[model samples]
Target: MLGQKNPPVDRGQATAIIVFILGLGALLPWNFFVTASLYFKERLAVNVAVNMTLNMVVNGTHAGHTKDYNFDSWMAFLSMLPLLLFTLLNSFLYQWVRERVRVAFSMVAILLLFSLTAALVRVQMEPDTFFSITMATIWFINTFSAVLQGSLFGMVGLLPSRYSTLFMSGQGLAGIFAAVAMLISVLSNADGINAALGYFITPCVAMVAILACYTLLPHLEFARFYLNRDETDKQPIEKMPIKSRDKTVLKNSEDPKDPEAPVLQDYKLPEKHTHNQPRLSVFAVFKKIWVMAACITCIFGVTLAVFPVITVKVQTSYRGYTRWDKVFTCVCCFIMFNSMDLVGRSVPSLVQWPRKESRLFPVVVVSRVLFIPLLMMCNIPDSKLGTIFSHDFAFVVIMALFAFSNGYFASLCMAYAPQLVRSRDCETAGALMTFFLALGLSLGASISFLFGYLV
Candidate 1:
C-alpha cells in the first residue's frame, strides 16, 4: 500500500519559493556591486577632479566612466573575465567537490565579501589602492557566484521545468531590486559612504536568510520526493538489482546535527541501477541539448550587444521638453526594460508559447537578433544613418519589446535544456547549459564595442 502511494504534494509551492529565493541570492550580491555606479565613480575620482576636467577639456572626450577610474573599465573587463572563466570552470567543479560544498562554500565566501565591501565603505584610502582591493574582491565574488549559479541550476533541473522558470524569473527580479535600491539612494541624497553601507548590508542579511531556507529545503517531503524521484518509484528499493555497490549508500543520508534534514540525497548516486543507465559525459549532454544551447547563445549574444551600450545612446528627441531628457535614459532604458523583463519571465507560468519541442522556439530566439538593428537605428545621434525611431514613445516601445524578448526567450531556453536529456543526464545538461550561458555573455560583451561603433 505504501509503495503504491502517490508522491507528496508540494503544499503551498514552498519548494518553488525556496528556488526563487536561492536564485535571487545568487545574483543579489553582484547586482548591488554593479548598481552603485555613482558611488564608485566618486570614490575612484576623489583626487583627480582638476585633472579629470583638464583631461576632458584637452581631449574633447565625453566626461564619463570611460575616462574616470570608475567601474566601466575595471568592472566591465575584469569582473566579466573572471565570471566567464569560473563559470566555465564550474561546469567541471562537480567532479571534485560535493554539491553541498559547492553551494555552501560559495554562499559563505560571497557573504564574507559582502561584509568586507560594507566595511570598506567608510574607510578612506587612495583611489589606486582602493581600486586594487576592489578589483580583487570583484574577481573572487564572480568566481564563487558562478559556481553557486551552476550548482543551483543543476539541482533545479532535477525537478520540473517551472521551477527553472521561477529561478530565472527570480534573477530578473534581482535586477529590479537593485535598481529600486539605487533609485532610493539617489533620491535620498545620503552620503556615498552611508548609502554604500546600506547597499552592501542588504545582500548580507538576505544571504543569511536564504541560506537558512536552503538548509530547511531537504527536510520537506515535498522536495525530497522530487529530488530523488527516480530512485523512490512505486517499487521497493529491495527489488532493484544491487550488483556490486554497497546498499548502505541507499540509507537515508540526512544530516546528523539536524537529523530531520535530508541534505545529502540531492548529491547521492543510486545504490544500484535498474536499467543500467549510461553515464553521460558533459559533451554528450551538450549534444542532446545543442539546439536549445545555440538558441540561447544567439538570444543573449544579440541582447548584450545592444542593451545599455547602445540603448543609453538612444536619447529623447524632446531634450528640453519637460525635463524628460535628464531622466529619460534611466527611466526608459534601465527601469522600463527591467520591469517589463520581470513580467515577461513570469508570463511563462501562465503562457509558454513556442513549446520547447517546437521548431518555432529556435526561430523566435533567432528573430531577437533583429532587435539589435532596430535599437541601432533608434534616436542615436552617432548613427550615421540618423535616427529612424524619433519620438520618446518610439524608444520606450522598442525597449519594452526588447526587454520582454530577452527575459522570455532566455527563460524558455533554460527550462527546455535539462529536459532534452535522460533523467540522470538532466543535472549535467543543466550545468553545461550554465557554461554556454556564460559563454554567450562573453561573446555578446566582446561584440558590444563593435556594435557601439556601428551606431
Candidate 2:
C-alpha cells in the first residue's frame, strides 16, 4: 500500500482509436476539398474583367462582364490524378519499404507541408495565380496521400475485418465533420481568408494526430500480442512446446475466458512453411479476386468522375433560398451524400447485399455509370443540355442514391476480397484492391475534365 504502480493502458481501445484516426486522416483532405468547393470557386473563379477599355481592358458588354471562367476545368483532373498513378506505384513502393511506420510518418509530414503550402498560396500568391497553384498543390498532395491510404488499407486488411469497417466508417465521419464546418462558415458569413485558413489548418492538425496515434500502436500490449503470435509461428515447432505456445494465446479484455489468439475472422494464418517452398506470388492472389477488382474499379471510377466536379455545380432552381445560395446548395448536397455514404459503408457489417461472387455485382457496377450523365443533367450553368431534374430536391434524391451506392459497393468489394484468397495473401489482396480504387479515381477524374469542357 506504500507505493502503487500505474495501470496498464488498454490496447483494445488504443488500437480502435488508431484505426479510426487512420481512416479519418486518409480522407480528411478529400472531404475538405469537396465540402469547401463553393468557397474556393468564389475566391478563385475567373474574374469578370471582360475587355475593350485601353485596347481590350474592362468590358462595356454586360453579357461579357457577367461570364466567369470555367474554374472546374483543371481541378477535376488534378484531384484524382495522384490517386490513380501513385496507388499503382505504391504496390511496389510498399514492397520495397519494410517499415510501414516510417512511411506513415513520412506521409504525415508531407500532408502537413502541403497544407502549410496551401495557406501560403492564399496569403502570398496573387488572385490570378490561385486556380493554377491550388490545382497543382492538390495534385501533389493527393499523389503522396494515396500511398498513405494504400498503406492504411493494407494494415487494416492484415487485422480483423471489423478494423477495416471501423476505418471506412471513420472516413464517413470526416465528410460529416467537413460538411458541418462548411455550413457553419457559410451561414456565419465568415471571412473568406479565415475560412480558407481553417480548411488548410484542420487537415494539418489531423495528420499530426494520426502520426501520434501510429507512434503509440507498436508499443501497446494488445498490439504486441498479435506481433508475438507472428513471432511464435516462425519458431521451429520442435523447439517450442505446443502447450507453451498455446498458453501465450491472446485474449481480449472483453472475452477473458477465451484462450484463442485474436486473428482475423475472415482470414486464418497459413500452416508453417517448409524451407524448400517459395512464397505465393502477388499475381496469384490478384487472380483469385479479379472480379472484385473490376467491381471496385468501376465503382470508384464512376464516382470520382462526377462527384464534387459535377455535383457541386448543380445549383438549386428554388427561389426561396437565395442568400448564400451556392453555399447552401453545395453544403446540403455534401452532407446528404456523405451521411448516406456512411450508411452504405456500414450496411455490409449488418448485411452483405448481393453475395460477393454473384454475377449481379458487375451488372450493378455498370449500372452506376449512368449516374454521371444523370447528375450532369441537373441545373448545370451554361450547358446546352436540357435540364430535367432541375430542382434541388430532385438532385438531392439522385445524389443520395449516387453516394449510397458508391459507399456500399466499395465497402463490400474491399471486405469480400480478403476472404477470396489464402489467408497470408489477404494483405496483398487488400493492397491490390486499393490500387484499383485509385485507378478508378484517376479514370473518373480524367473523365471529369471532358465533362468540365462540355459544361
Candidate 3:
C-alpha cells in the first residue's frame, strides 16, 4: 500500500477511472434480477401461496404441531438459520477470491442457482403454487447477488480513496441503463412463459458476456503516482547560517528583485509528519465501530424485507393494472431509488452532517424510527387512502421513499465502515455487511410469507 502521493486527480479523471475499474456492466446483472422478479409476477402470475404454506408446515412439523401453534411465526422462525449461514459464508468467501475471478464466479453462481431453483419450482409446483416458489427462489438468488455486489463495492473502495467518486458515477450510469432496459422490456410484446424466460435470460447472458470481456481489459493502477509522506520527507535539509546586517545589506543591495526570490519562497515548505505504520487489523477496526455496523445491518434487513413485498402489494391490490404498467412501475421505482441512492453516496463529500461520535447513535435511531411509519403506511388500508391517492400510486410513492431511505442509510454506512476499520479489514467488514444483508433478506421473505398468510 506504500506509494508516492501525486496531486489529486480532477473529478472527470476520477469518474473515468472508477468506470474503468468497476466495468460498465458490473451492475447489469444486479438489476436484471430486479426486472426478472417483476416480469414473472406480472406476466406469469406465479403465486407463492403453496411455498409459504409448505415452509409454514415445515416449521410446524419440527414443533409439537399443537393447536395453539402459529404457522406464520413458525416460518419466520425457521428461515433465520439459512439466512444466517449464507451471510456468514458470503462474508468469509468475499476476500478469498481474486477480484476479477470473483465477479465471474458470482455471476455464474447466481445465474445457475436461480435457473435451477426456478426450473425446479416450476416443475414441482402446481400452476397455482409456481409463482410463490419462484419468488422465494428469487429471494435466495438475490441474497447471493447482494453479497457479491457488496464485495465489489468494498474492493473499489480499497482503490486509493480518490477513486471512490468515480465509483459513484459509474454506479449512477449503470442504474440509468438498468432502468431503461426495464422500461423496454415492459413495453415490448413479452408475456407468459416465453416472456418470463426472455426477460430473465437475455440480459443475464448479455451481462455475463460483457463482464467476461472486461476481464481481458488491462487494469490501470493509478496508486503508483501518489507519494507517501515518509518518501517525501527523507530528503536532507541544509543548514543555513543567519547573515550579519552588513552581509544582508550587501546581498540585498546586489540582488534586489532577483529572479531566484520566487525559488526561495517555494523552498520554504512546512515540515511533513512521518508515521510509517501498517493499516489496522480487522479486529482492531471492528472494535472501534461495531455498533454502527450492527445498526446498518439491521437497516439492510429492513430494506430487503420491504422491496419484494412492493411487487406483492401491487399484484394483490391493483389486479386490474396492465402487465406493462406493473413492470413499468417496478422498473421506474428501481431506477429512481438507485438514482437517489447514487446521490446519497455523494452527499458526504458535498455537505457535512453531524459527525460527532455520540451523534451517530441518535441519527441512526431517528432513521430507524422514520422507517417504521413509512412501512406502516404501505400496509394501510387502500380504502382509507382511496380518496387521496390510488392504491397503485400510493404504493409506488411509499416504495420510492423506502428506496430513498435505503440509499441514504447505505451511503452513510459505507462511509462510516472504513473510518471505523483498518485498510486491510475493509474486505472483512464488507463481508460482514453482506452477511447481515443476506440474513435480512431471508428473514424478510419469511416475514412476507407469514404476513401474507395472516392477512
Candidate 4:
C-alpha cells in the first residue's frame, strides 16, 4: 500500500545504497592524497622550477635568476578547480539522465577524458618542463578524481528512502575509519609530524580503490530502485487528481466565480485529499536551485576566504613551536572542528534553539560575521595570549563553531528545499546544494589569493 504513495523497492535503490556505502569506505584513503602532496612538496618545487626555467628558455625568454614559485602553494590552489568543475557538471547531469547506465557511462567517459589528458601531458613533458606539466597533470588527475567523488555522492542522493540506512551507515563508518587512521598515524610515529605528513596518501588511495569497486556495481539495480520503474517504463506518471473530496473542491475552486460551487458547498466534507502535481521543466528547477546555491556559496566563501592566511599566521606567529607541536595543533583543530560538525549534524535538535527552516539564514549570516572578528584577532600585535590563541587555538574554535552552525543550517535548508518544490525535485535540490558548495570553494580560494597579496 505504501508503494502506492512511493514507488516499490527496486534493484536501482539497492545498488545506490551499496555504492553509497563503498563511497564512505573511500574516505579512509583521503589522507593519502594530502600526505603525498606534502611529502613531495620540495621535490615538486624543484621540478616546477626546472620546468619553468626550461619553458622560459624554449620559449626564448630569460631563465636566469627567477624568483621561486612555490609549487606546493600553487598546486594546492590549482587542485580545487577540477573538483569544482566536476561537481557543477555532475549537478547538471544528475538532473538530465534517467538511466543508471547512462549516468555510469557519462561518469566513465569524463574520467577517461581527464585521465587521458593527464597521461598525454605526463608523457610529453621533460624534467625541465615539470611546472607546467605538473600543473596539467594535477588538473587532469583532479578532474578524474572529482568525477569519481561526485558520482559516488550523486549515487547516494539517488537511493530510495528504504535503503537510505545503508548510505548513512557507510558514511558513518567511513568517518570512524578516517578518525581511526589518523589516530593510528599519530600514535605510531615517534615524531607525530612525520606520521601526520606521511599518512595523507593512504586516505586518498583508499578512496580511489573503494570508488573503483563501487563503480562496477549493478547499474540497472540503481535505476530500478531509485526511479519509479513503472512510470519510467511508460509515458511518466500522469498528473491526475486523487479520488478525494478535497480534490473535487480544488477543481471546483479553480473557477472562482462558478455558480456550481453552491451545490458542492452544501455537502460538507469531514476530510479531503488532493493530488499534488510535480513540475516538469528542468530549467525552472535549476533556477530555483540557483538561488539556494548562491546563498550557500556566499556563506562558504566567507568561511574559506581566510584559510590561506590562517596557515601563514600559524607558521609565522607561532614560529617558536616545534614541528610536532604545530602538527598537534593542526590535528587538534581539525578534530575539534569536525567533531562539532558531526555532533551538530547528528543531534541538531540539541543545539537548535528554535528548530525552524528560516533559522538557517540567520545562523549562516552570524557565522560569517563571526569569522571577520576572529580573523582580525590574529593580527593583534601586543596581546601574547591573543596571538598565541589565534595561532594555536582560535582557528579550531572558529572552525568548530562554523561547522556546528553550517551543519544546522544545511539540515534546515535541505528540509525546507522539498517544500519549495514537488517531491520529485529533491534530487535537483541536492544538485543545487553541491553546485553552491563548489562555487563557494572556488570563490573562497580566489578571494584568499587576493587577500594574500594585500596582507
List the candidates' TM-scores in order.
0.85, 0.79, 0.60, 0.62
Choose 1 or 4, whichever is better by TM-score. 1
Per residue, candidate 3 scores C-alpha lDDT tens digits across 236-343 of 211111232224223333243653221121111222332234545555656766765666666666664544443344332455667745674445456666666566
Q: Name the better of 2 and 4 by TM-score.
A: 2
lDDT tens string, model 2, 309-364?
78877777765766748575646577888899888887777787798768888898
- Candidate 4 Cα deviation (angstroms), residue 237: 10
Tens digit per residue, CA lDDT, model 1, 1-455: 22233334567789989988988887886778877766777777773555567678999865565344636657767766877787777778776887778999899999999899899988877667778888888889988888888888888887767788899888888888887886677567777777789988999999899889888888887777766745663232221122432335434333346544433322323334533656588888788999988987887788778877899888788877665666677788878888888778777877888987798888888888888888888988868767888888888898899999888888888888876765567667777887778778778888998988877
Task: Please give the TM-score that candidate 3 achieves against the real structure.
Answer: 0.60
Off by over 4 Å in 2: 1-12, 34-71, 118-122, 126-136, 226-278, 324-327, 377-385, 450-455
Pairs in steric clash, model 2: 52-56
Candidate 1: clashing pairs of residues: none
Listed per candidate, the RMSD to the true structure in angstroms reads: 7.6, 6.7, 10.7, 10.2
Clashes of each: 0, 1, 9, 21
Stretches of model 3 off by over 4 angstroms after superposition = 1-31, 38-87, 94-100, 108-147, 160-183, 191-194, 209-218, 223-282, 310-339, 356-365, 378-399, 443-455
Ranking by lDDT: 1, 2, 3, 4
* Candidate with the larger lDDT of 1 and 2: 1
**Alpha-carbon lDDT of model 2:** 0.68
Best by lDDT: 1
Name the weakest run of 10 consecutive residues (lDDT summed) in model 4.
265-274
Steric clash count of candidate 3: 9
